[model samples]
Target chain A: MTVQLQRSATVAGPVRRVRRSKHRPIWEEQPTIAGYVGKTVALTLIVLAVLYPLYTIVLTSISTQATINAAGGLVTVPGEITFAAYRQILSGGIVTRATLVSIGITAVGTLLSTTVSVLCAYGLSRPNSFAHRPILFLLLATMFFGAGMIPTYLLVSHLGLIDSYWALILPTAVSAFNVLIVRNFFMGIDQAITDAARIDGAGEWRVLGQIVLPMSKAVTAVVALFYGVGYWNAFFNAMLYINDNSKWPLQLVLRSYVLQGVTLPGSGVGQVDVASGAVTGLPVKMAVVVMAIVPVLIVYPFVQRHFTKGVIFGAIKG
Target chain B: MSKQVADAAPARPAGTAQRGTADGGPGGRRRRPVTGTAHRRTSASVPVRKVSMWAQIKRDRSLLLMTVPVIVLLAVFAYVPMAGNIIAWQDYSPYVGIVDSPFVAWDNFERVFTNPLFLNAVKNTLLITAFQLVFFFPIPIALALLLNSVITPAIRTTIQSIVYLPHFFSWVIVVTVFQQIFGGASQLHRILAGHGVHFDLMTDPDTFLILITSQAVWKDAGWGIIIFLAALSTVDPALYEAAVVDGASRRRRTWHVTLPALRPVIILLLILRLGDALTVGFEQLILQRGAVGPGAAEVIDTYVYYQGVIAGDWSFAAAAGLVKGVVSMLLVLGANKLAHVFGEAGVYQRA
Candidate 1:
């Protein structure tokens, strides 16, 4: 957390100090007025490019059919605001069930993935270990070369995981990327503490459960957040394996809703505007997007401080 | 790497000759030249079996025991599936199971080579990946340099956070957001058309590639900057000070100092890009296929999904997947080897 603060403080303090010095050398000081104008213009353009589409999405979500037709489309603001879209989507059985299923899968999947990944990572990181090298190689090889989808699907189907909750959770329980990150983190812990545990005649399981697990809150939290997001965003596996509508995750449901644009019987978007294919004028799609993403968006900010460090493990040196 | 470690194992009897021949003293295994008395030896001796392989393993039992579950898991999942790659050569049918499926020799590979869709998928996958490398790769580095030079901290962090937001959005949400903003019912087109200036991007075929690439940059550019920024931070400030003392201009200093400093990271990231060259955002392409059509958007992963999953030809799909997997692995290994030739520690140490 302090890393972000410390970075800003260092960058700003030096630049500000150099700017105020009347006698400072031109080469060492900050840029001139023209340069400032150029940088400002460029930054403004970049910001607008990033934000405009998002602004349009939000604007369209609130606009009525009349407003959409009158404007021909929206850019900044809608002519009118309404909650009909939100009410309609929520009232619909598809969105509600999809939302609930997504929540259940994400919550349970994150817990299982994080726990298994951490235990496996911690186990592999121990020194002088029999299984360490071979297992690490196994994990790393999978990162480079997966067995592709056919075998994976066959494996899942063979296990009778088809149409079950396990179909989503089991195949994805321990991501090699997350395991590597957690293992690297465990290796960074002080050896003296682990040595003390050995001196106390503690077993490998006891030392892991009692000592290493307790102190790795940051990485543990980061890994859990990663798994949570992965589970929430997962669509392909569910799309392929899960035929049971009741077990459909949110992303798959959203895909069908957005792409097929076919509203189910109780979806409350009111009488098929079948002529247009899409609910053509309705904002239920935006509502679906919000429903799918709101959980992670809410959770991310709490753990945002670790985001940079957590994901950048192998990028720099690999 | 594990192979190297396995070869160097201390417990292996193969190392005993090297160990014994190198050192022949109290810690080594050779008769003492000066000690003639067996009684004296018995009083001072430590048991040789204590240093034996079985005893060494026992002493390190805690470490060995800790890694059991990891080994078991990997054996069951990763290694087992690798063994399943034998199916790539077969006419693998689910009804018959992996073992029972009759071997079809090179038929799958032959089918993949002859199929127009598979060839198009390869071309499309490479094209999109190359576009990403060309347009999307360097923006983050440029953005990081700009953000690094900002005089304000709060503004910098806020912008950074905002830019990183799209990365967390699912591809479905990202595509939906774009459709809402620019599709046939797009608000921007409506706003422009109201002023008698019609601008339509949703249906424009030529502009679709640029739109997809830009969307990719918007989503990933900020997140990607973390690596470049980490590299930038490690550059010595003294080098900049020296350049300043020599009257180097700001632009000159950045080029001569910062860019050179970031070269290793830039190269490393490029190598990674090469490794992931076969993967061109599968979900992104699949989601937008309706708008852009399969010609521009079809890639290897999507093609496999369509051919195998949608068309129900598991063997052909498996063949396409195998080709991609093999080509990508070769590309990475070759890149790693070249990196070593350039005097960098490539993915691992060379024996």
Candidate 2:
């Protein structure tokens, strides 16, 4: 029965195989005349639909203030290009401060969260431990029931975390879902390697740090990206917990820009205060959207491959 | 939603490991040394046979030690706050505190149940979730099927990368993107107005559900492609080859072979989605609330925000949140059981 399962796994699994399809003839594989045309049209439509809206955002962001307003909103082309909008949003103190705050929070928060996840996951994956069942049940129960938000807020407030960065970090630092994913990945490690380490007199932490993690880099990277992206995109907690404008993350700042329809340029605000007395501000607002998304957009292409790999390896039953 | 996603992993591991150990060690480890030398086994090998719970504890002592901080944190922040659900039955005041507050005993729940506004939010949530399960769920499967059929790795990877980019975008950006094209500044709006037409969907309460659902699709559909893609790889190539030899059309082969092969995955994903129906994306609703107002866009999470946190009525907010949490938990449990009853693997064991 075990041998049958092993055979099926190798035959069916996608990740294990590396193939060279040299046996197939390229010319014969080429689609017939009608099929070629259909494929081309379908591909073209898919590409256009995805690209056009993104292109419009880029086009508007680079458009000059005068041209954008003159066009009565963005059109096919910007007619002129200017970096003044970006300069205005960037140089202004609000976005600058918020960008730094978001960076600091994401960096520190990701490290802290990932570290705790690794520790707990390593602990939970052990065969039998004193704290295993109780700890596991406690965490599992958390997945079902939470103290709700008010009790959570009261708890944080009671701890004097209100108006502090800890408010953003502490409550959300260790995700139960993320922990399970990492733990699953750890469990996938060859038991022989861990047993060999144990025979060599290595402690649990040493075995994890020296053996398990190095082999588990792919999943760890995925978890870090997940945690990091979540931290960077998080603004609700900041909005709810922190009242001070100086400490607001970029999302909250962007939200305010959208709400007020204001474009504050060169003063550090991405969206100008059109309502406050600025003319031709839509370009600036477009620039703010561009500014808000660019960092994550840059990081995304690098991590996309590993993202699904990590999720699948963690999600499926072995 | 929280319970659904979280509970699935735990129940599987806990059940399998406990049963696997009791029956004998996992099959692989059991086959090794003991079979080679039954009576000649060293004391070290025999020690496992005498395994007491305390011995297991001693073996995993360091691991147990490391799990301490995690347990404490989850207990205090995650579980302890659950007790605050009592406030949902009371008139909770921050100044008066949870203890001294007047116990309204279901008044908040009664108000939520009776109010037309609250009922609308529930209706909207269910409607949007149902639409999501139908219109949105299958796109990714179709996409994964398409991608799997494509032999070109470069094209597949590039498309996947571009599509997945939206997953990381903040709800603020997603809503802003929608507003840019559909709001006052939208290219479509200008084009329509140029052609002597007018349409306002962004602020139109009637169309808000469609708008929100589309935004959700745009943001998450690519991410959903992952699971379907994973499941598709498990389909037997032999099945496709047999169909091809029988002169089957590509579409027919896919329909007969591929779709049937995806049954387990489809059922499993459906159960998961039902479990997550309550959590209809918190940040998205909050961002769009001002435009659509409470009439079309208010939800359980946003309601808690406005009533409890924003209004400083902590008790009422606590109650609303508790109801959502409990309802979501029950939904996942029921969904898992239903999946099992249908001869599918539920979140946990087969039975």
Local error of candidate 1 at A188, Å?
1.7
lDDT by residue (tens digit), candidate 2, A1-318:
346445544544454233323322221123455765676576666556556667777787788866776666664665888887677777757877888888888889989888888889899997655556677767777776666777888888878888898888888887888888888888888899987987676767788889999998878888888998888888789888889878888878888865446444446444344553332566667777777788887777677778767888777652
lDDT tens string, model 2, B16-92? 22421311223333233222223243345555445433334434555765676677677677766777677788887
- For A146-213, candidate 1 gives per-residue lDDT tens digits of 77776677677777888998788877777888888888878878989986985676665677889998
Model 2 error, position B226 (Å): 0.9
- Candidates' DockQ values? 0.30, 0.33
* CAPRI-style quality class for the chain A–B interface of candidate 1: acceptable
TM-score of chain A, model 1?
0.83
* Collision pairs in model 1: A72-B190, A73-B187, A73-B190, A74-B187
After superposing candidate 1 on the true structure, give the runs of residues whose Cα lies further than 4 Å from its correct spot.
Answer: A1-27, A59-75, A78-82, A269-281, B1-73, B190-205
DockQ-derived CAPRI band for the predicted complex in model 2: acceptable
> How many angstroms is residue B177 displaced in model 2 relative to the true structure, after the best TM-score fit?
1.1
